[model samples]
Target: MGRLCKLHIQNDFKEFYTPQVTEGGVVCITRCDARHKTPLRCVYGSCSMTRAGPECECSDRAAFWYQDQVCRSRISKVGVAVGVPVAILVLVTIVFAIVLLRSQRQKEEYRNNLRSRSELYDSDDGNWDAPQGFAVGNPAATWEDMETPSTSYINLERVDTSRNIHIRRPTVVR
Candidate 1:
């Protein structure tokens, strides 16, 4: 059972990922293949060395800056930086759409109610007329009795107030 639990044919390095056993657990990691070692150098971690080096000594637990075959780190900072704003924008758009849809629905309902009431009122007289008291200063006049008024008006208001004032000649009283 112990021999079956030991991994000996893997290419990548893993830290503290072995299965528990009755006897003990192995902490030292060994590479079965030599193709995982790369010439890349980490730029943001504690050490500048590559995760998989010439020797089998990488623990595979450091926060490497880049993703390689041996060491792939999490990108939580970048994910949160972009994901939070995108989530907020999506939520705001959804809320705005819902508000606009509700307002349009309310307006449609109001128009429908007005139309139904107008139909019921116009049922008696087949001729559709304006609502009661809608016409100002023409309560008794029907639509045919109203006439187009003439546009003859006088513009007598003084509009040139900014011009120079005329000086009155002094009387020859001297």
Candidate 2:
């Protein structure tokens, strides 16, 4: 137990022990692994510590954290193929609907002219038959009777513009 303590942990002398070379208790920014796990060893307070150890600390632990990073496509190749055709189909359907609407609009004036002439002839003949089997949707079985006339008259105002007056608002109390 009389072995001279040639080594010490600088800024930390709380523990005292004799350590062999393998028991690397050298003063360094990083902790050194000692074979006997007794911490650093040195000869006569020499500032001979090198920062790096002979063998790399990270070597043994590398396999546990190894990652095989590779680039991945956001959309699958098959999905891209299918989606392009579907998008084209929707665009074609929209164009067809637009063309149909335009054709109908172009014939609107002719249709209206025919309707007015036919209506005039219908009125002259005094025939109320829904023209040529046109199914005017179903009529209601009952209807409301007029209880009162829709419009009424109310007296408006007397012109009292004799003097200017300021109005005060009533204050509310909680």
Q: For each predicted model, how many residue pairs clash, with residues at least 3 apart or on different chains?
A: 0, 5
Top candidate when judged by TM-score against the true structure: 1
Q: Model 2: residues >4 Å from true position, as ranges?
A: 1-70, 117-174
Instruction: Please write out the lDDT profile of model 1 over residues 30-119, one tens digit for every residue.
Output: 233222233333333332223453232233343223344333354455667788999999999999999999999999999999998877
What is the lDDT for 44 in model 2? 19
**Relative to the true structure, how large is the alpha-carbon lDDT of every model?**
0.46, 0.42
Query: How does each model score on TM-score?
Result: 0.33, 0.27
Model 2, span 24-121: residue lDDT tens: 54332222335435434322121223333322222222223312211111234465578899999999999999999999987897799899877644
Q: Which clashing pairs does model 1 show?
A: none
